[model samples]
Target chain A: MRGAILHAPGDVRFETRDDPEIIDNTDAIIRMSATCVCGSDLWDYRGINPVSEPAPIGHEYVGVVEAVGSEVTTIRPGQFVIGSFFASDGTCPHCQAGYQTSCQHREFVGAGGAQAEALRVPLADGTLVATPEIPSDELLPSLLAASDVLGTGWYAAVAAGVQPGSTVAVVGDGAVGLLGVLAAKQLGAERIIAMSRHEPRQRLAREFGASDIVTERGDEGVARIMDLTRGVGADAVLECVGTPESMQQALRSTRPGGGVGIVGVPHGVSIDGEQLFYSHVRVQGGPAPVRRFLPELVELILNGEINPGKVFDLDLPLSEVAEGYAAMDERRAIKTLLRP
Target chain B: MRGAILHAPGDVRFETRDDPEIIDNTDAIIRMSATCVCGSDLWDYRGINPVSEPAPIGHEYVGVVEAVGSEVTTIRPGQFVIGSFFASDGTCPHCQAGYQTSCQHREFVGAGGAQAEALRVPLADGTLVATPEIPSDELLPSLLAASDVLGTGWYAAVAAGVQPGSTVAVVGDGAVGLLGVLAAKQLGAERIIAMSRHEPRQRLAREFGASDIVTERGDEGVARIMDLTRGVGADAVLECVGTPESMQQALRSTRPGGGVGIVGVPHGVSIDGEQLFYSHVRVQGGPAPVRRFLPELVELILNGEINPGKVFDLDLPLSEVAEGYAAMDERRAIKTLLRP
Candidate 1:
């Protein structure tokens, strides 16, 4: 099998590796059908996040089950499936509460790696959501997104309480944020303000249903949102950037009694309790429970309700995985799809 | 008129003050029937929060309306009324959205000095809720409690998303926290856990419907809560303590996807975003919009559905107001009510 590994900062290598097998009774091996580069991956690639050792690095995948362990009952070989970044036992108290990311028995897929020809998935019955039929090439990208980004964006909208007539503001123009715009639109937000300085991403945001755009950042961004909403601020805000400034902007851009759903991985972020308390802005989100939304999102994609796959602007063969990482790191691609 | 003024730390003196009158068109003059010391007032009284100058300091009050400005129509003279610490126009977007504390036209009642013999309440028509009728001595305390502590506690329960059959935990042993125990019980929470070491307060908590009590503080407190909830934590937690430790315990004590409603006035508290993000605890709350709940709460008190005024364990004459602050400060009284 060929897999991508991060040996150190700014280093990604595609090399031959032993094929994965079902090691645990609840495990299953999947032949990767598609995978993609994520904004989070850039953290390790840019060396901002120290790389301690060489390890498999992708966690999103839409693949076909190649084999299953003796204990697996629900999922079988030859089925196309989308799985969450973290595997969760469906029976845990947290999982039952629709917060699978915090499940008592949860496992991250980073160790197994999605950017590989084949991968082993633990708790296959609980983690994998199987598609009803073989999907067309046109539908594959969207299903692949349902594995992480799209579901995450959907979770952000839900967490922010984007209601039918809500005015939403999205912070960050990454694939996830743009997808959040789409999610807010689908959820019936009357107006969506997307904050993005980049022209290309701004266009993508508009296509995903942004009613307005604020190219400014920091305090200026909050000013723009307040100006747009007649000094009241947006009713719901989606925070897709985890920086301290972005977090503040998101909090400041929301109206009193509104909510800010943060999906970005926080990096050295600290929020003042006094400001948050006085603002009355609710906050709720974590590593999205993608598994919880897979069923509905899969249906939405099958019905052509959303075109989130447009976020993938670059595609490359599995052997050229380094170029895929480089394209995203260099900001040349919004998201890069890898064919295994 | 006479009022209680904090000339300096630990120095509260009852002194003569100019009589309050209906200065604004929307203002109403109220002859004080009762006022009480608050937890937040302790910040200035204990010298933890610096007092810039000598000023009359008290905000919670329930009194008889003595006169009204030309613009005031809904409320009449001789009516018994209760108003929040903050006066609001009630027509602002925030007020309409049930966040009257953040109303566009809002004024702090601290300047009017509820502790004085007379108070001029701005936004009289919006800020004050008139009782159905003059109450007996037994009912005056409960109606007065509805002015601040009870309303604040009810908001905490609502913000925490307390529901039928839900498990709730209150983090403070103060008046607000004890009232929160009562609010949780009234809101149909199946189990209420009160964190308090004080025997009298614990008795009050149990009477207010606390099913369990945890006396430990900080990390040990979190551990005890986790132990009680089968290591999963409660479904809703009311954060009545504003310290970083109390805030973290509130977050840690709530189950994943659960909410923590913080009503305590925060002082020098900062929360790490990364910890909050990964914990999957939802947080929402600010200064309670007591005016929003006035209608139902007024009815509840009139019918004796609750008795939140029991939190006030000491009574003081207007001249002995110094003892009122001392009682709460020295932990000799849970709360002190003052009569003019």
Candidate 2:
């Protein structure tokens, strides 16, 4: 089987590798039907995050289970399924409380390499949620999104405490940010503010139910949000970019008693204690327990209540994974879907 | 009027100042019956927080209203009252959302200085909560505690989402931290874990409903908390310390989905974004909106449901203000009360 591996910075190669096998009694082998490039992946491709050694990459996938370990009872072979980036034993206390990312027994699926012809997923019974059936190619992109980005965006909205009649500010224009707009809309936000200078993304944000768009960045961005919010700031803010500026904006653009949910993979974000303490905003985020929202998101996607798959503007064959990475890194694509 | 004046670091002199009159239309003058030295006062005394010039130095007090401006209708002269360190209109959006400390027109009462014989309070209609009647000396300590420390502690518990059957961990054992334990108990926390090494403070914490006292510092403290919670951490954590280590400990001590409320005046606290992003802990706090809880807290104190005033271990005359500061700085007293 062939899988994507990073030999070094700016290098992604799809080469032959031994097929994965079920290792743990609760593990299963999944043949990938679809995978994609995540925003975090650009970190390594751009040399911002150093790749110490050649390793398997990518963590999002929607596929068919090929084989399952004897101990896997809920999931079986030949079933179509979606898997979260982190494999969780759903029975753990944290998982029971809807924080699967912090599950007592958890594994990063990327370590097993999901961007391959086949992948090994641990904790199969609790990690993989079987779909109604093998989805059509048209439904594949949206289903695959539920594996990470869509569910992540959903988690961000939920974490920020978005509810009916709430006002939300989204601070990023990536796929996750767009999906966050969709999620906020689905969650019944009365006003959704998308902070974006890019015209294309701005259009998509409006289509996703954004009531307002601000082209400012930094202090100007916060000012625009304050202006639009009658100087009270948004009721909730979704921080989909994890830079220092984004974090600060998220904190500052929220009403004193509001909430900020950060889903971006933070690289160098450092928050001043005095600022956070005085801001009076509730801040919460993490790896995003995507599995916790997968079932509901899957149902929503199947019912056509949302079209998060619209984020994937570019599609490429598995052999063109390098171009997919480059396209996203260079802003040529919001998201790139890969067919295996 | 004689007030505590910080002429310079290590130089606190009792000096005379002009008697304050209602300057703002919303202002009121109060005759101080009692005030206290706060932990943060020592910062300027130790030169950590510079005292640029001679400045009045105290923020917490309970007293009798002496005079009021024409605009002050809700409160009148001769009413015994408890006031928060910060004055808020209580009609602002932030105040309406229960975060009065971040009120748009909020005023720090210390600027008018409560350590004097008579003090001027701004936003009188919203800042001063009248007592049922003149509080006895016994109730004075508790009501004065409500002016800041107890109110701050109560905010910490509320922000940490303390509820019935919840297990809470409190970091810091100063007057505020010990009071936090009391607040958690009042909020019905089932098991309260207090991290403190001071024997006297520890005793007060236990008396305030700390079920367990872990006399460990830093990692050891986190380990103790984890060991007690079966390695999952407490359901809620109260961070009463403003240092970086305390912030990290608070983040680490809470369960993945738990909440942390930090009220310490964060001087040099800087939080690592990646650390907080991956931690998945909900963090909320600030200079507590003491007025938001003042009325309810006063009712509880008057009804003898709780006794947070016990945190004040040393009482001194207004002339002994310097000694009061020294006693807390040398760790000789948990809190110091001054009668003017």
Candidate 3:
């Protein structure tokens, strides 16, 4: 087997690796059908997140189960399935509350790296949700997206409280933010403002149901959103970029009594308690509990209700995984889909 | 008119002042029936919130409408009224959204000093909620409590998403926190944990419907709450204290996907974004939108469904307003009620 490993900044290598196998009774090994480069992956690829040692990297995938541990139930070999980056024991109190990412018995499924020919997923019965059938080739990308980005964007919109007649603002131009625009639209938001500086991303955002696009950043972006909303600010704002400035913009662009759903992993963000208190805004963010929405999102994708696969602008063979990483890191691709 | 003024830390003086008069078209002058010392006042009294000069103090009151400006409507002279500390034009978008405290056309109603014999309340038609009829003397304290503390506590519980059978933890034991216990109970929270070290406040909390009391602070307090909830943490946590420690305690005490409602006017609180991001807890805070809850709270008090006034443990005439402040500052009283 081969997989992508990050050895240092600007260095991703696709090299031979040991084949994945069931490590526990709850584990299942899946032969990867599709995988992709994630925006979060760039965190380590850029050295912003230190790489103390070479490690397998990707965490998003859709695959066919190749084998299952003796105790694995519900998920069987020969089925096509998707799972979140985090493997959760679905019966935990946190998982029961629909926050599988915070489950008491959780494991980072990315530890074995989904960028490989095959990967081992723990708590298989709880983590993986199989499609009704093996999805067609054209539906592959969207199904893979259900493993992370699409579900994440959906969670962001739901967490932001986007509802019928809601005015929503998304503060990032990445795949997640664009999908957030789609999610908000699906959730019945009446108006969606996408803040983006890139032409291609802006176009995709508009196609994904962004009613307006603001080619500005920081304070200027907030002002534009406020101006567009007639100074009341949006009913919900999605913070898809994990920087302090992006978070602030998202927070400030929301109306009093509105919500800000942050899906970005904060790098160096600190919120002043007084400012938040006085803003009268509600904030909820975390690693998206993608598992909670996997079934519905998979259904939506299969029914052709959504086309999240549009986010994959670049595709390559799994052997060219390093190039895929470079394409996304260099802004040459919104996201890269790799066929394994 | 006479009012209490803070000239410096620990220096509250009762002295003659100009009579409050209607200044805005929406203004109404009210003759104070009762005003109380608030925990927030101690911030200034303790010099934590700097006092630049001698300023009229107090923001909570139950009073009789004495006069109204030419354009004032809805409220009539001689009506017994209860209003929030922040006056709001009821027609503003924020007010319509039930966040009157964040209303665009907001005014600090306490500018004229609610501790005085007379107060000029702006946005009279919006801010003041009149009782069904002139209440007997006994209901004065409860009505006054609705002006701020009770309303704040109620907002905390409401914002924290308290629902039937919820496990709620209140992180403060002052007047507002004590009343938060009452609010949680009224909201149908099955298990209420009141954090307090003071025996008197603890007793009051139990009376207010605290099912359990944890006499610990900071980390230990969080541990106690976690232990009580079988390590799952409370479903909703009310943060009625404005300090960073209290905020952290409240955040730490909530289970994933739960909520923390904060009503305290934060002085020096900052939330670490990464910590909050990973916690999967929703946090919403601000000055209580007391005006939104005024009518309902007033009815509850009038019907004797709740008795929040029990927080006022000491009483004094307007002339001894200084002693009232001193007693609250010295912790001799949970709260002090002043009569004019």
Candidate 4:
């Protein structure tokens, strides 16, 4: 089996590796049918995040279970399923409370490597949600998105407390941001503001039910949002970009007593506590517990109520995983889908 | 009229000042019956905060309405009332949303120099909440507590999302922190953890409803909270101290998905975005909208449901205003009340 590995920053290679095997009573091996490069992957590719070892590259996937251990009672061989970015026991106190990312026995699937032909997933019974049957080829991309990006965007919206007739503002234009617009729309938001200067992404945002578009940066962006909201600011803000500037903009774009739901992976950023405290804003964000929303997102995708797969702009064979990384890093592709 | 004046960091003098009169159509002149020294007042006294000009020092008070402007129809002379540290118009969008401290036309009563014989309160119709009748001498201290400390503590508990059977931790043991224990208990918190090192304050905290007292500082404090909760941490943490250490401890003491309601006036604090992001905690704080909870706090005090006034340990005449400030600064009293 061949898998994508990062030799170092800016270098992705696909090489032969031994096929993964069931290592524990709760383990199962999945034959990957589809996978993709996430926005977070660009961090390592761009060398913004150091890659000390030749690490596995992707975390989002939809596949067919090839083998399962005796302890895996809910899933069996040959069944189609979607796995979350974070593998949760799904029955811990935290997971049961809908915080699978903080699950007591949680594991980051891709940290050990997920961009491979056959991937071994632990906690199979609680981590993988099996679909009714094999999904159609056209449904694969959307179902795969339900594993991470779509569910994360949905979590961001839910954390921001978006409700019927809410006015929402999204701070980033990445795939996750686009999905956030879709989620806010699905949650019955009356107005969705997308902040983007990129034309292609703006088109997708509009397609995803954005009510307005603002091409401003920092203070200018906040001004645009305030103007759109009659100076009261948006009822909720989705902070999809984790930079200090983006977070500050998100904080500034929300009205006092409003909420800012953050889903971006925060880098080394510091916020003035005095400003945050006086803002009278409620902030809730962390790693999205994608598993918490996976089942529902899977159902929504299968029903055709949403088309999150529209974020994928490039597709390639697993052998060319390097090109997928390059294209995404170069902004030539919003997302890359790999066929194994 | 004699008022408390801070001429410099270490120089608080009792001096004569012009009697205040209604300056706006919505203003009212109140003859203060009682006022108290706040922990925040020590910020300037200790030279941690600057005292640029001679400023009036007290922000907490309860009194009788001496005069009312033409536009003040809701409140009239002879009515006994309790008001917040800040006077709010109470008609702004923020006020309507229950964050009156961030009200667009809000005015800090302390900055207006309320530690005087008579003070002019702005937005009288919305700022002053009248009691059924004149509170007796026994109820004066409690009603005065409702003016700021008790109200702020109540806001902290409410913001922390305290539930009937939840565990809560308070990270300050000043008058406000001690009152937070009272507030948490009133909200039905099952176990109240008060972080304090002072013997007197700790005893008061337990009396006020602290089920546990941990004198540990910094990381050790976090360890104690985790140990108490079997490693998960408290469901809620109320940050009554504004220092960076207190903020960090508050964040660390709360479990993932819990709340941290901070009312401390953040001075030189800076928060690491990534740290807070990974915590998956909800935070809401600022200049507490004490006015929003003033009505309820007054009712609670009047009904004898709580004794937050017990935080005051010294009583002095209005002419001895300097002594009141000195007593709190010297740690000779938890709080000093001045009768005008």
Give me the candidate number with maximum lDDT: 3
The candidates' DockQ values read 0.89, 0.84, 0.94, 0.78
Error of 2 at B284 (Å): 1.7
**All candidates in order of TM-score, best leading:** 3, 1, 2, 4
Provide the clash count, candidate 4: 0
- Residue-level error in angstroms, candidate 1, position B11: 0.6
Model 3 bad stretches (over 4 Å): none
Query: Which ten residues in a row are the worst by lDDT in model 1 chain A?
Result: A15-24
Residue A318 in candidate 2 has what lDDT? 87
- Per-candidate fnat, comma-separated: 0.84, 0.90, 0.93, 0.81
Displacement of the residue B272 alpha carbon in candidate 1, Å: 0.4
Check candidate 1 and list the clashing pairs: none
Candidate 1: lDDT over CA atoms? 0.92
Q: Write the per-residue lDDT of candidate 3 for residues A1-340, one digit (tens) a residue.
A: 8889888989899999999877899999999999999999999999999999999989999999999999888999999999999999999999999999998999999988989889999999989999878889999999988889998898999999999999999999999999999999999999999999999999999999999999887788888888998899999999999999999999999999999999999999999999999999999999999999998888999999999999999999999988999999989999999997
Model 2 lDDT tens row, B1-340: 8999998988888889889987899999999999999988888889999778889989999899999999999898999999899999989998899888888999999997777898999999989999768888888999999999999999999999999999999999999999999999999999999999999999999999999999887899899999999999999999998988898889999999999999887878988888888889999989999989998999999999988889999999988999998899899999999999
Ranking by DockQ: 3, 1, 2, 4
Worst 10 residues of 4 chain B by lDDT: B108-117
Displacement of residue B27 (Cα, Å) in model 2 is 0.8
Listed in order, each prediction's TM-score against the native is 0.99, 0.98, 0.99, 0.98
Candidate 1 wrongly placed segments (more than 4 Å): none
Model 1: chain A TM-score against the true structure: 0.99
